[model samples]
Target: MTHILLVDDEPHIIGLLERALRADGLEPVSAEDGESALQLLDERDIALVVLDVGLPGIDGFDVLRRIRAGGSTVPVIMLTARSGTADTVEALDAGASDYVPKPFVVAELLARIRSRLRESAGASTVLTYDGVTLDMLARRATVEGHDIDLSAREFALAEQFLRHPGEVLTRETLLKQVWELDFDPGSNVVDVYVRYLRGKVGASRIATVRGEGYRWEA
Candidate 1:
């Protein structure tokens, strides 16, 4: 079972998260504050950390910095009441894997946690298919000895396709996995971006299935 470490100040919040994580078949260990969270870091098997930013004793960011300074690459998802862009950027700069604003929906939080943990799994995610390669770690893609630069959204879309190479990806699945939301099929955004990606990754790398969606080629 994936082990998740949850740190928050509110007892109710901890209880809620624990229940949700447990229901998902994950073992959740929690801390009431940053100090205790830092202490719990001594455990080596924690796969991911969901940390609340406004804790007493050591602040979340402070604890995060200490965690990174010790060279721990454990993925952290920061939960903060501050929804400002600066706050998000600051947490990302401090080595947070992702950020979720408080008053979060349980479903959205679960999705975010899943994505962060996959990214933290690093070595296991170097997806490859046919002659193309995607190194999620280096945020780089290559095909037939050529390197390509992909926009963040494009890269995420490509990542999805790579994971299911040779399989048709329904529009809804692509939208949910890449944008985390449903978008109108009439919207050209996905098509336009896929065109851009195909141009770089190889003209025939991604194939359109008419009204269905797309598929990664063999």
Candidate 2:
């Protein structure tokens, strides 16, 4: 059984998520604070973590940092009431596999969780295009044999482009495939991340189609 650690101080939220996760065939382990969450991680074989940013102590960011510091690559989805670009970037920069703002729809969160788990369980395959390489199993990206540091989201975005080289991937398609968002959120998130990828992968590699979307140049 896949055990998911739910770290939130709110009992109602935990109960809500527990019911939802259980209904989706996943076991839920609850933790009210960061300390307990870390202990549970150590004692149990947890596959994923749904961590709340605000906790009694040790906070979600600290917990995520500790998890990464311990060299554990377990998928962590940060849940926070604070919905800001800074907070989102902070969570991703801290090695969070995904971020869900509080008051989020349970169904959407579930979709994101499943997406992350599927990516985590992806088969070992090396994708090479031009001078870039992506190790699917290791979730590593390299350019010209040099390692490129990428966040979980960035890596996922890169995978989509590599998988369909020369295909113009619309923003809607990228959002659905990469962020698991089925609807347009009216945000520039796709463009923002594409710029990030261009800076690392090469500007000319991804061509922006005016009135359309983006295409990976083959």
Candidate 3:
């Protein structure tokens, strides 16, 4: 079972997150302060950390720094009420894998957690299929030794395809897993992005499965 550490001081927030995480089929351990969070990281086989930035002591940034400084690559998603760009940047700079502001939908946070967990599960940071290779850790893509510059979304979409080569990925699954969107938002956005990806990589690399979806040809 994947263990997630939830660090927040608020009882209500902790309760809400615990219930949501449990419902999502994950084992969640929690600490109400930064010190306890740091300690739990040592004591538990935590796969990810959902940390709140505004804690009583040490703060999320410090905890994040400490985690990195200790050479732990465990994914962390910082939850903060501070919506300022600076705070977000600071958290990212401090080694946060992702950020979620307060008043966020629990579903969205769950989606983010699932995404990070999937990323962490990859045997290596680099994913390769056919002649194409995606270096997830460096956010770089290459085909036949030629570098391909991709937008963040494009990179994510491509990574998903590369991770599951030869398996047909439904458009709905792509939207939810890559975009973290439940509904299509009434657009051919997936198709558009697929087109964009096909343009970057060879069009033949990703095959359309007619009534199904897209599959990365291996």
Candidate 4:
């Protein structure tokens, strides 16, 4: 599982962010102060960092500096209340991948996180699961060496399932990531796309998790 380091002193914010990250298939490790945040960076193989600038100690800029100086290229997103131009410039200069201000919309923040991850995922243009393959760069799908035709949305849905095989992905998560819809549209779009993907991949390739959502068979 990919781990995300969340550094914030606010308990409420931490709790909220943790749940949000988990729902998106990320494991979040929390630290309330800058020292612990730095410690976590050393202790865990974190895929990314969502850091607060107003930390109790060491501060986020210092932590970001240390991370970059230590030769760690791990992506960092500064999450802070400060929206000043100088503050944003400093965070970016110190090696932050992105910055999100407080009172942020959860969907927007998630979108930024996904965008940063995509930028960092260099040259990863293909995804395969159980002989089903998705060519991300080419926008193509294939099953067992046979080419399969899929719509744009169908390909995105299949790519998500292939990336996280065996993990039960909620309809909400699918809708958010694949369609960029933060709330359910009161429609069966996810199920409809899943059926389209299964037709091209195979019927048994994806498992419906009853009321939960769907899971790509491992």
Candidate 5:
């Protein structure tokens, strides 16, 4: 009964994905362009989005920015023909929950989708460590009494740290838990987002492990 929004211009791609998603017991809602995709997001209770980067107007990046700016924390898995690392990093940096390059295997994509949905469904409503607080249901984070604006990725990373305070969360663990990535993507994305989180939640809260990873400290 989970509804997934599919945003892509190509009819064949949508058709293929639609069939696959239906077979997986998920409902598929299709949009051929970014505008429609945005509108659908506004009008429907979409659980997740499968967004294609090359839209006719208001490309995938822009659409993602808009989604975040609107304060929607719905999980988004971006699909793009560009297989470059730059694009992958850019999509992640832009707040995508996951990225899939074109010509992807259906099984892998389905696994990613299931992973994200499970993460979403299993989250606790609120987590507070020291003065930092995360409202998982609202997808909002606050430090002390002030609100902190966090992108989807930042919020997820913060959630992981708070859930296991004082635990040494290695980069690989973070990559898997926060980014739903099983292998290292050979990017400094984890470090980059950690810096971003520190800026908002105070630097002393997350300690660097020198050679290992990071730990949330009181």
Candidate 6:
């Protein structure tokens, strides 16, 4: 069975989600705080995570940062009650696979999780850009004979730039397409990920637009 890790403080919310997930044929394990959620990672083979932003003692953003740092590939769906676009964008920029606003339909959440799994399972092996090759299926990258191992985020970013080569992408555009967020002016999360990509893709492959965004130089 596909296991889902649900992290939320509200007992009612957790219960509702757990029952719904089980009804949809998914087994869900849950945690009520960031600390417990982080601990769950070590104990569960969770395929996906439903994370709440208002978590205590680490907050959703901090937990996400830690998750990324730990190199886990579990798809994440962030939950936030706020209607602020910035928060949504920030969640995406921080590496959430998707987001669910408070009061979201359980079916919609299930659909999102299924979609992500399909995409991940269907990921292509090789991605080439201006002679820089990223092999998603292989988990390797080669640029002019120099080969390197890429992390999950690196591969995702490389795919984005390769798909839209030379197109000047604002931080917002990159965040949304690559990270699945709406652009809200000043999130450094995108920039941080771009730097990670630069180190992998060779910094020269990406060009910065002063006072604007960036583009794959190709």
Candidate with maximal TM-score: 5
Task: Assess the local accuracy of residue 7 in candidate 1 as a C-alpha lDDT between 0 and 100.
Answer: 94
Candidate 3 C-alpha lDDT tens digits along 96-170 = 778899999999999999989997886477788888988765667998989998875787789889878999999
List runs of model 4 lying over 4 Å from the truth: 123-218
Per-candidate Cα lDDT values, in order, are: 0.81, 0.89, 0.86, 0.83, 0.90, 0.82
Clashing pairs in 2: none
Task: Report the lDDT tens digits of candidate 2 across residue range 44-102.
Answer: 99989999999997999999999977867788999999967788778877878888887
lDDT of 5 by residue, 1-218 (tens): 89999999999989998999999999999999999999999999999999999999799999998898787778899999987778887888787888999989998999999998997788677999899999876778899879999877888899999999999999999987776666665878799999999998989999999989999995
What would the per-residue lDDT of candidate 1 be over residues 142-169, giving only the tens digit for each residue?
Answer: 8875887776577778888887888998
What's model 6's lDDT at 42? Answer: 84
lDDT (0-100) at residue 162 of candidate 5? 92
Query: Candidates sorted by lDDT, descending order?
Result: 5, 2, 3, 4, 6, 1
Cand. 3 Cα-lDDT: 0.86
lDDT of 6: 0.82
Clash count list over all predictions = 0, 0, 0, 0, 0, 1
Question: What is the Cα-based lDDT of residue 69 in candidate 6?
Answer: 68
Q: Which pairs of residues collide in model 6?
A: 125-137
Q: Give residue 7's error in model 1 in angstroms.
A: 4.4
Model 6 Cα RMSD, 1 decimal: 5.2
Show model 5 residue runs off by greater than 4 Å.
136-139, 148-156, 175-200
The clash number for model 3 is 0
TM-score, prediction 6: 0.70
